[model samples]
Each structure stands twice: as structure tokens, then as C-alpha cells.
Target chain A: MFCRRRNFVVLILFCYNNHRERFEKQLGEVAEVVMKAMELPELFAVFLKIGCLAFGGGYTVIALLQKETVEARGWLDNNELTDIMAISQTLPGIITVNAATMIGYRRQGLVGATLATAASILPTFILILVLTHMAWGFTDNPLVRKAFTGILLGVAALILNTLRKTGKTAVNTYADGLLALFTTVLLLGTGLNVALVILLAGGLGWVKNLYAEKRGAKKHGTD
Target chain B: MALINLFMVFMKIGALGFGGGYAMIPFLEAEAAAHGRVLLENYIKVIAMAQVVPGPFAVDSSAYIGFEAAGIPGALAATFAICLPSFAASVIISKFYAQFKTNTGIKALLDGVKPAVLGLLASAAYIIGVKPLYELSHSLASLTVLKAFLAIACGYFALTQKRVRIGTLAFLTVFALVGILFF
Candidate 1:
């Protein structure tokens, strides 16, 4: 019975991975054909759906956006979505805002982007407000304090998980590796501006990419 | 605590917030310390609310601080201010994206930017993780080690990426319940 139960758990995980793989395959094949043009109300509604329910912060919601736009809605192809992710990360704020702004702008226009931004934050704004009210009394309460600590621990785990996943892909080449190392040191070690660090790092990458551009052509030669 | 000052503080933080939500933790903490506005105990609540809320942690935090400082209007101001830089950036980038989507120069720039983001995540782990995990827990004597270990155990599982987000939240609730019951 234990063996059967364990197998069932494995089966469920397998099915989920398989489902994701299938979605990815389809996304690759058909991403180019359909371009969803959503109106203001429709745009607001879609973002609202994501904003209200999607938790665990910005990076966590990237996958949700991928599912909603690339897989389900076909608002953007996988390539465009990848581009958006990269761009969003490079920009400021959070992944949620950056992603929403890019996606909304791409699908609609200025108004579309504004609507998306508003929709994305409205849930959080209201929610924090509610929690703030509840939070007042909970401070001296030992139970809630202990619970908060526990939750913070869990949050730590989630962040470390994301860091690992992102690091796997982000730190690829020798230059990239060095860049990652340096960035980790600089940001943590010094009071240097984060924005300046980003700008300078991007500058370095640009130079490296330029150096590699010709070599890259020779290596890949297909593009 | 003028609304404008609230907005400006957030705007500056927003500008500096390059890595992501968690990466901005130190900046927020500093602002809290410098201003002496949010008491440490209350700030725990800020962090709590920041974590539990649906948006980015940084954004949620600013809203929390804003509300703490001023009121609903302050919250609105802070929220609006933080969103300003990113929104403007998005608009500018959107305009240029089409013209430069495939441009080698733009691609190269973003390429360099990517790894640094990875670095930020590393720092985020240290900067954000230390406070609640070690600092706060140390104050308690009984079962401090056990509580810390429980957190570590959950964090380890969380790293497995098996439904990470909701999984973390689930584990948090379960651990919280356990904490309530046991410790």
C-alpha cells in the first residue's frame, strides 16, 4: 500500500512535468501564428486575474504570465515572451511591473500598459491595507510572531530556490560567470548604486557580445 | 511625514531597486532605520505584510510604510511614486523594442545585464535571509535551534522546485500551525 501510494505521488509529478513539456512544445510550434489583440477591459481582466491570485512575488508570477500569455492566450510567442522576460528583468521595479508593462504595451498601447499596471497592483494595494489593519494587534501576540518567523523561513527557502534556478541559466559563459561573481561581491560588499551596477554590467556585456558577435557567427553560422 | 517625501523616498528606492523584490530589502531596512518611522516590532509586521501580500515585496513594503507614515493618501503616493520609474521605463522600452528587437547592440547590453541579475539574487539570499531567520529568532531562548532547523528543512524542500510558490506557502502554514501548537 505504501509502495502504491508513493507511485501515485510520482505519477502525479510526472504528469505535471509532462503537461508542462507538452505546453512548451506547442508553444514553440504555434507561438508565431497567433497575436492576441486585447481591448482595455479585456486586458484589465486578464491582469486582474493574475494579480489577485498570483502570490510569492514577482519572479513567481513570471511563469504565470508565461502560462496566461504565451501558452493560453497566445498574446506573444515564446521568443517574444523570452525577450519580454529579459527586458523586464533589466528594467527597474519588480518582475511583475516590468513584465506587465512590456506585455501590455506590446499587445495594446500606452493605455493598455497603464491598465495592466493598475490591475496588477490593485489587489496587492487592497490586500496590504487589509493586512495592515489586522497586523496592528498581532505584534505582541506570541503565536502570530512565531508564525511570522516560520513563514519567513519558508520565504527564505522559496527565494533560494529561485536563485538556484535563475543562476543555472544566467551564469553560463566565463565572462558571465565572472560578471556574476563580481556583481555578487560589489552589491553585497559596497554601498555602490544598484542601478549603476546594472548599467555598468550591461555595458560590459555589450562589449563582450560585440567581441563575440563575429565569433558567434562563425560558431553558429546559421543565423 | 509629508506625502511628497514619502513618494520621493520610495522613488529613490525604486530607482535603486535593480535586482528584484528581495534584493531591495537592505534599502528598505535602511530607510526605516534612517527615518526612525517604523518601529522594529511594527516593521516586522511590515515585513510580514510585505511577504504575504500579492505584489512584489518591494512594492508591498513601500505601500505598508507609506500607510504607516501618512494614511491611505500616503499609501497611494508611495505606490504611485515607486511605479513611476518602471512605468516610464516600460513605455520607453516599448517604443524602442520594435525598432531594436533583434539589434545586436541591444542584445549585447541585456546580455551583460543578465549575469549581474544572478549576482543580485545571491546577495538577496544573504541580505534578506539573515534578518528574520537568525536575528529575530535569536531573541527567543527555548526551541530556537529547533525552530531554525524546521525553517531550514522547509527551505531545503522549497529548493527542490516542486510547486515552489504554493508549496512554500503551504509549508509555511503547516509550520506556523506546528509552531503554534508546539512552541
Candidate 2:
């Protein structure tokens, strides 16, 4: 019996040591990922790159990232990508970079986040830097001006398309449609502030929901 | 004094800029007016430039304006200042949201904000659209009517179309080439 008990204690110690070792290894991996991405200049360049190529704003970037990272590289799964997109939209900062960072962090921890963000932004930053330097000299160049005009028209089309798509998803009910129309009128007709409009809309939406809930509860109670 | 002023003004913008970049415009305009460092016309130019450039419109524009105002350091400072409040709020809200994921009140509040946010976005789009369209109409050129019709058609097409592909870029490039060669 004593021998058996001694063996059991040894077994417990062995299990504990093995568990600790695995935990340490996982932590080390996470740390390595985080540290790898902390380089500022390289990461900044990545951001610039993403900015340059990523047309149609937030959604476009999300889809591109998914194709490149999730499908091509197998860095993340669909569900995870969706979750990050949702969270990124809800948060502030550039949504694309935020999503990129979150996905990277999830995949390889910090280093991944940093590298991914840098990779995404680098193109835009460099392009902008070059453009800024040349803008004065090229400001009146007919070809450059024409090119920009065409790009602007394209951008307008893209934005209008996005607004329609976003509206379809966001404006589900009559109340939502009314709210959108009202907001549009208020903003366009008057110089009503955008922040105030959002706050008011958010507040109204909450109140409306609560009122509906209470009414439902009362009806149920009566029944 | 100027740098400190820049910091404070941007901090206010950061705090109040809900519903993302475009939503921050009026606040930015008001602040820019107050500072007088940049003229309203110049501010509008910066916004236009921002829209044409990539990434989040307001943030990138802020950086560009900062660079214009005071160079690289200024750019960094402005960017940091504008993002500070949103970053803090996001981090805090994220923590709170994790704990209260299913709380009805929280959910209701978020639902309430949706309409308002949409309103803000819609308003920005309309405002941006109006200026360009008006300018085009007033130009009295032969192509003015054509451009106006095209713009309206694009808006309608966008509303009806199920999908808008990047192929639009190829069309734009072709149009640009034609404009360069013919017009």
C-alpha cells in the first residue's frame, strides 16, 4: 500500500511538471508574436501600403484581409474573421488596421498584429509621402489633374454604392427608414452636428426598444 | 501656445467624434474656426484631400493637416491626440462589454445608437455630394448636363445594383484615358 501511494504522488508531480512546461511554452509563443510586431517604422509602412490599395473603405479591407490571410495563408478562420470585423467596427481607430491587428494577435500574438498592421498600412503611407512631396509641382499638370478627377468620380461611385449596401443592412424597419430620412434632412437642411445626431438617434433607439419591451410585458401579464 | 492649442482642440474632437470620422466634421470645422490656424476653405480642402486618400478619412486628414501645419512631429502629435479618446473609450467599453455581453440595457443602448450613427453617415454623404453636384451644375459647360446625369445615374445604379465590383476601376481608368486623349 505504501509503495502504491508513493507511486501515485510521483505520478501527480510528473503531471504537474508537464502541465507547467506546456503552459510556459504557450506563453513564450504569445510573447514572441507580440514582440516581433513592435517595430514602429516597418509597421507604419505596412499601414501606408494598405491605405493605398484598399478601395471602398472598411468592408473592402476586411474582405481582402480575409482572402489573403485567412484563405491564402490559413492564419484565421471565417468565424474569427467575422467576429473581429464586428468588434473592429464597434471600436474606434481605422477599422481595417484594428481588424488586422486583432486577427494577427489571435494568430501569432503581438508580433503578428504588428506585422499585419504594418503590411496593411505601408503602401498608403509611402504613396502619400511621395504625393505630398510632388503635389506642388504636379498640382497643375493636366494629366495628373485628369487622373485625379477620374479617381474622384470613381470614389464617389464607390461611396454611393457603399451607402446603399450599408443602408439595406442597417435600415430594416419603417422606424429605421424614418430615422435615416430624418437624420439626412437634419444634416442636409440645417447644419445640425453629426455627433449630436448620432447621440440622439442612439438614445431614441434605446428608448423605443425599452418602450416596446414594457408594452409587451404588460400584454403578457394581462394574458 | 499653438501646439498646446492644437492638442486641446484635437482632444475635444477626439472625445466628441462618435460614429467615426465623417461624424467628426462639424466639430472639426468649429474647432478649426476657433483656432484660425487653418482657414475654413483650407479645412475643406484638407477634408477633400482626405476623402481622396485612403484609410479612415478624418484620421488620415488630421495627420496630413498636422504635417502641413508643423511638420512630422506635429503630424504625430495631432494623430495621437485625435485618437486618444476613442482608444481609451474603446478599451474601456471592450472590457465592460465582455462582462455584460447579454445585458438587455446595454443591448438596447447599442440598438438605439444604430439609427443615429446611420443618420450621421447619411448626412455626411449628402453634404459631400451636394457641393460637387451644385458646382458641376453651375459650370455652364456642354458636358455639365452629361456629368449631372451620370452622377444621378450612378447613384441610382448604386441603389439598385446587387454587387459593385472592382471592375469599376477599369472603367474609370478607361474614362480617364479617353478624357486625356479626347477632352
Candidate 3:
């Protein structure tokens, strides 16, 4: 009986090891697919060609995704696409990649998400990586410098535009505007940390909401 | 010393960066200041660079900070660290999201977070816009002032104007072209 129990323990250990190995192999495969998708021309070709061909940047990308995934491929519905966009923006990563991952996962599970993310990022990553390398080599090239200057100006414009749109959507009241203004002054004037600015803004927003609620209650009582 | 310090510091930042990239800025700034590796002005410049670059603004910004703090290795480490949490979170969350799709409490929590997210976004915009205008005013440059005014006007137009779809980009491109040519 003791010998039989020893044999049973050995069998259990063997099964556990097999299971662990299979799990590890699955994870390895996922990582490999993700990395390999980066170099796959067909995968990146779609994203790169679309990005290059498209006129606008951010919204254009959204439109392109709608066309490719919804209209052309019929991978997702309009509502699903919109939902993905909303969730993606709330998340920490790049919105485009986040959207791609969501759609991909919806279509083909974990492997799809990995491939889609790699594909979506491939174009920008390769372009920027190449540009960074080239910039280092051609540091003294006047044309390169001029082009960079132009790019910087373009970037500044893009940011300003983003701020405008974001402000319209985000700032709804006098209190919100004041909070924005206050946070802005603190950040730019004093060169306070961005993290601190965000925290303080969040805290102040909560406080303002409380104040407003209390004031409303008092007014209601008076009425 | 600087590079190694930056790698270690940003690794900590990445580990703690839960909310978003913007959420990581204060921690980054504190670490930089503590090390005396990066000056405040340069730190702001790094933020600006991150904003200008493509991809996720926060990740790019963190990478830029790491690079500025040390060099290439610093950039790699910082980027990796910053990206690690989101990557892990994504995998874990993806697994559970389907299960929680119909959970009312989760929905309510998400609703609560929405207004806060809006507030954060608003705060970011205001912070970014004010800096340049303040600097331009301090310099007392007419051209800078004009540019600042144009930015504000463009912002207003973009906000109020409904018919124009690309109003923001239009303002940006025009101002940028003008700045490049004249300023």
C-alpha cells in the first residue's frame, strides 16, 4: 500500500509538470506571435498604407478603422466600434492599439489581440524609430533640421487643437473652468509636477462638487 | 550614475503608474528632482516633446524623460517599465471584462469615473495652453502675443463651430505655417 501511494504521488507530479510546461508554452507562443507580427509586411502593410494614405491623423484613423473593420471586413458593428473607442480612450495605452486589441480579441481571442496590437503599432514605431536613428546621424543636415522644425510646429498645432476639442467636451460649468484655470496656472507658472497637478485637480473637483451639492441643499431649504 | 538612477527610478514609476500616463508625471518629476539629474525647465521640455510625438503621449513622454535623464538604455528601461503595468493589466482585464459585462455595480463605478476622467482631460488642456501664452506674454513679443491670440481664437472656433469638421487642424496648420514662415 505504501509503494502504491508513492507511485500515485509520482504520477501527480508528472501531470503537474506537464500542465505547467503547456501553460508556459502557450505564453511563449503568444509573445512570439506578437513579436513576429511586428515584422509581417502584410499585417503592418494595412496599418502603414492606411495611415500614409489617410489625410487626417487621429480622427482619420478612426474612420479608417470603421471602413476596414465595419464596412469592408464586417468584423464589428457600429455600436461595438464606438464602444471600443470609448473604452480605449479611458485606458492607459494608445487608443488606436487599444481599439485594435479589443476588436481583434472580439474576433479571434488572445492571439488576435496580440497580432492586432503589433500591427497597429508597427507603422508608427518603425517610422519613429527610423527617424530617431536618422536624426542622430544627420544632426547637422540643414534640410533635416528644417523638416524637424516644421514637424515641431505641426506637433504644437496638433496639441493646441487637441486641447481645444478636449476643453469643449470636458469643461461644462463655471466651476470646471475655474478648476482648469487654476490647475493650468499651477502647472505652467510654478512648473509644478504634472502628477501633482492631476491629483490636485481631481481632489478640487470632488471638493467643488461637494460644495455645490451643499449649496443646492441650502437653497432648496430656503425655497 | 544618472542613467542607472533613471532606470531604477522610472521602474518604480512604472510599477506605481496605475491611473494613466499623465498620472505618472508627478512621480517622475519628484524622482528627477531628488536625483538632481534633470532641471525643472528641461523636465517641462520633456513633457512638451512627449506631447508633440506620435503614439501614446504619456509613454512617449516617459521614454523621452528617461532618454534625457540618461541615454538610450535609460529610454529602453523606462519605456519597458512604463509599458509593463498596462500590458499586464490588459491581459488580466481582458479575461475578466466579459464576465463583468453585465455587472451593475461595475457599470455604476464606471459612470462615476467618467466625470472624473473628463475633469482630468480638461485640466490637461488648460495646463498645456496656459504655459505658452504666459511665456509669450512675459517676453512681451507682439508676434508671440498674436500667435497666442490665434491659438485661443482657433480653440474657440473649434469649440463653437459645428459645421467645420477639421476646424482644429485647420487652425493648427495655418498657425504653424505662419509661425514657420514669419515667426
Q: Highest TM-score, which number?
A: 1
Off by over 4 Å in 2: A1-53, A72-75, A104-126, A141-150, A213-223, B8-54, B89-97, B132-146, B155-160, B171-183
Give stretches of model 3 more than 4 Å off.
A1-57, A136-160, A167-182, A203-223, B1-73, B98-143, B151-160, B167-173
Q: What share of the true interface contacts does each candidate keep?
A: 0.69, 0.33, 0.06
Model 3 CAPRI rating: incorrect
**DockQ preference between candidates 2 and 3, better one:** 2
Candidate 1's DockQ is 0.38
The lDDT values for all models are 0.72, 0.59, 0.55
> lDDT tens string, model 3, B1-183?
766666666655554342344534446656556646434444544444343344544555555566656666776666656554445545555668776566544443333233344434334443344443455467535565565556555555554556865543454455445445544
DockQ of each two-chain model: 0.38, 0.37, 0.15
TM-scores across all candidates? 0.74, 0.70, 0.61
Chain B TM-scores of the candidates:
0.72, 0.65, 0.63
* Docking quality band of candidate 2, CAPRI definitions: acceptable
What range of 10 consecutive residues in model 2 chain A has the weakest lDDT sum?
A: A38-47
Error of 1 at A180 (Å): 3.1
When summed lDDT is taken over every stretch of 10 residues in candidate 1 chain B, the lowest stretch is: B127-136
